[model samples]
Target: MAMTSLPSLPLLPLLLFAIAANVALGATIVKTLPGFEGELPFTLETGYVSVDDSELFYYFIESQSNPKEDPIMLWYSGGPGCSAFNGLIFEIGPLAFNITDYEGGVPSLQYYPYSWSKSTSILFVDAPVGTGFSYSKTQAGWYTSDTKSAWQTYQFLRKWLIEHPQYLKLQLFIGVDSYSGISGSIVVQNIVEGNEAGVVPRLNLKGYILGCPRIDATINDNSKLIFSHRIGLVSDDIYEAAKKYCNGSYDDVTTSEPKCYEAIKVYDRLIKDINKYDTLEPKCTWASPNQEEDMSRRALEETSSDDFILSPPKIPDMWCHNFNYAMSYWWANDRSVQEALGVRLGIVDNWERCNKSLQYTLDVSSVLDYHKNLSKMGLQVLVYNGDHDLTIPCTGTQKWVKALNLTIVNDWRPWIVDGQIAGYTIKYSESGYRLTYASVLGAGHSPQEYKRRVCYEMFNRFIHYYPI
Candidate 1:
């Protein structure tokens, strides 16, 4: 029932920094989380790292595994716009929102047993200037591209390390999911380049971790047809016709391919019935017209206005699948939660799970080359995809990895959890660099959320440099 609150810090105006440079180094130690019981078991530090005119926010959790010697991972959630908190509460963080008990009112919070923090320290960061509680002091700082964003994130980590020098010796890894796979590699490249250039307070860089990374739009887009056919969503005739008419390249469709277009139309109509993220996950029944205006604050104010349906779970076990996300909208937006997080008052008017306001520019087309460069650098890499995910099909990731042509250290084999096959894995090596490719069987876009226990088993082994 007891909680600790960060002291109120006045908002820094546009020119406020001219008065104090250390003002940007704002940080607060959280002893208790909003819906959590008792004191936090792990050290929770919420703070900002000033980068040029942008102030990036981050949540730091000390390792439950072995803080002294265990590795620390810097996480960037995908979406190119989704907040790192999504990665925290929904996937790898220590606590998850208890959306299952909600008939109405606040969503409760509970400790998650399968958090990656159990194996290593984790830093959930809000990057690219306009994500989560991160904000830009200057107008020009608000707009960013892939390359520019990586630079900013790199600088943010460097400064954060400089402030927390005790963590300088811990092995570091850049981790992310979804679209971040594109930028995550670039961020790692930036760190690798910085370390090579002899940057001060050097990082003990190890490797990177990716979850259903969206590296190439064209590659992933084309893989869907293949994925759909392989998963039995489309019949053999439909698959063959698409391959025959489209010439196996579905990345870009020609206006002349009428039969290809017809086949795609049929595919779209059929696939619409299933949840695109995971074919097995049930589709949300959209809120009815009469209940449209009668929605929760999370639904009305913070839930993304994207076309996807935002409904409470119909089944008990699936209650928190996406509904727990609604709690984020409510919790983060609450003035009390903001104060607990040490918000800069008026500096952040509101927080979106994924900031829809970012003027993000996706300039870097593909990170395949970035991965290629890292592959030669002798770093350890882990790339895992949910086999059921349609967003960035495993086939697309396989497409790029096969292109790398690394020697197979371990042939593809079924990975077991509790003595039962959970998914599949293959190991590749070249010039001391080792890469592991894993398929999270039957899971969705974010396997960490869909199958936490199995993912934790896989993560524990990977972080410890053991076989999964």
Candidate 2:
């Protein structure tokens, strides 16, 4: 029997995991990885899904409960350029970086008490060829669009299932958030079409999940002003005046409208200091052309994060809240860490949380039609947003959801977590379809990062079709 092996002492664990997986394919089972103090408690497999010349990398974590029985989730990161590691370490993965320090080395890994993988198997993917550890063999393979990404992802899923036949029967969900919302909708549609065509290794495609999805840029941008006004960021005079002058055209304002431009300018200045993604949290790193965010010479340090961990950076009181992401940047880019994860060298010059330099094209600007069609299908859907997220405001999600026109199964009400009001949620059902819309109160973009346990509880119940 041919047995796949990884480097070092972890090979024994890898062999065990491979035997358990039944079909290893070209996957690497990681037992001991960098950052964490000791051996991992759960099984993690890092491998590539071939999509033509491009190799999309993914981190697969088996369910800690019952690997064979638990449902599977394909979690694609948003940003169209951001790595899926955010959804992994920060959002739902089993292990996460303890972000309590700032001394700037490898961020130590710790077991999250409410990891999504406790009962649900998750596949965190770095898609579109250029995100995270995923890369293309040829330069031409890097250029991708909304439509192309969906098809590629579909093909990837099919091939992945073919390789790991044991997991082919698990109930599947395509989970996406942020800018990937556009491609995510298209991807879901592709899966539905594939299933209808009677494709090989038939997928038990159940439903899809969206978190703070940027469904429509026009609506999202316009709702920014509404969200701002509702949160008391701007005065009523400015808000009403902009509405009167701008005519709800936020993205493409005319040069002729000087008053409107000035109003927007002031609004931008006011919120420029705010981290539009998560208003309550620290404003992390943002890149610029002249100089990079973290140019630390003390990088590639993966010995032990305990020795280097420092207190969290002091957030500035002014317009800038500098929550430096040096720790994560260092941890991911470390040579030892990459080797431990079995990452292909020269695939990417560096690992950025969000590879903003990818040549991604915006083919589908809005997913209004997709959401409407999904609502008609006999599928369960959950659309959640951080109420404080100004980028893809819940107001925009609410507007599109209202457009779905489903019967109100449950009227709007506050949902509780630990006896405190966590957020507001509403339920809708039409035909065989059931949709749940929720808002994570006082949380900014990516509610999972802000309220982990609460978001996990929300997801756990939503997936099981229980009351929120």
Top candidate when judged by lDDT against the true structure? 1
**Tens-digit per-residue lDDT, 1-468, candidate 2:** 111222344353454355446536568889987778788999999988778788999999988889898889889878776778888887888877765543456667888879889889998889877778888888678777788887788777766766676787889988998888888888888777666765544678888899999788778878888888988888999888888878887666666899889888877788888877767655544431111223222211222333222234443342222233445568788888988888886556577776656666777778898888877778888889988887789988898889888999899999988999989999999998988999998877678877888999999888777899
Which candidate should be chosen as best, given TM-score against the real structure? 1
Worst 10 residues of 2 by lDDT: 288-297
Cα-based TM-score, every candidate: 0.88, 0.87
Where model 2 places Cα greater than 4 Å from the true spot, the runs are 1-25, 101-105, 281-284, 287-324
TM-score of 1: 0.88
Candidate 2 to truth, TM:
0.87
Residue-level error in angstroms, candidate 1, position 117: 1.0
True-vs-predicted CA distance for residue 53, candidate 1, Å = 1.7
